[model samples]
Target: MRKADLLDELRAEIGAMSDKYSSELEKLYQFVCNSLFDNMADYQWVSIYLVEDFSFCLKFERGQTELPPVIPFGEGFMSLAAARGSVVRERIWNRTEVYVPFYHGHHLVGVLVVTGTAGGNIDDEDISLFCELASLFESKVKKCNS
Candidate 1:
């Protein structure tokens, strides 16, 4: 599909979602993974990592058996997103990495990482959608923490 079309579709999907419950956030994460898998068709793994105590912890994951242990906010792609406060994309020999930062007001919350086969690439649209989703997740987390 065209990049614009993919982005529009993602925006529509995200707009339809309601982040009123934690379960809804889980569903959103699953939806993102499924959408990425369907659209790109080369992802081996997709996961959501949230900030906790200045670290990024795996919250949900798909297509992977084991994930790295809790990661600090200054390490890995997740940390890169948090540190840069922006989306980071890179292509590896066997995998593609994408990280989108989550923000709560001015505070950095966490990041969402999507990894796919080398043939698949993460585009600007994917990064935007991931950041939007992360913002929703951050909002929900803030409400719960309050």
Candidate 2:
């Protein structure tokens, strides 16, 4: 499926499931990770890293391999995006990086990192959609926690 179509389906699913259960945030997190891998075939790594204390730690991941030890709040792509409150995309010969900020109101909560081979380089449209999904995920997490 095309990326737009994939995102549309995800938006629909998230909208439908957002308020249905007490564990909806966890379900949303799982859905985003699974949907991205299942629909975006180019992605080799997908994970959600939530802010804990002063660091961003991997809370959920999927695809070919596991992520590294930890992704701190102000390190690498996660830091760049989180600090700027925007999406960051990079294309390296063997690796591609995409980071989308997760926010709760005006506060940065975490980040979603999707990495893969160079062929998986995400474009502006993909980043925009990912940001939307990340917003929903952040909102649900905050709501559930509060």
Scored by lDDT, the top model is 2
List RMSD in Å for every model shown. 3.1, 2.4
Give the residue spans of candidate 1 off by over 4 A: 1-3, 19-23, 65-67, 138-146
Tens-digit per-residue lDDT, 63-101, candidate 2? 754456576655677889988888888776677788888
For model 2, the superposed segments whose C-alpha errors exceed 4 Å read 21-23, 65-67
lDDT of each: 0.70, 0.75
For each candidate, give its TM-score against the true structure: 0.74, 0.82
lDDT of 1 at 134: 75
What lDDT tens digits, residue by residue, belong to model 1 across residues 30-140?
676666666655566777777789788887776762448598767777777777888888776756788788777778766777887657666666667777777777777
Q: Candidate 2 — worst ten consecutive residues by lDDT sum? A: 65-74
* Distance from true location, Cα of 72 in model 2, Å: 2.9
TM-score of 1: 0.74
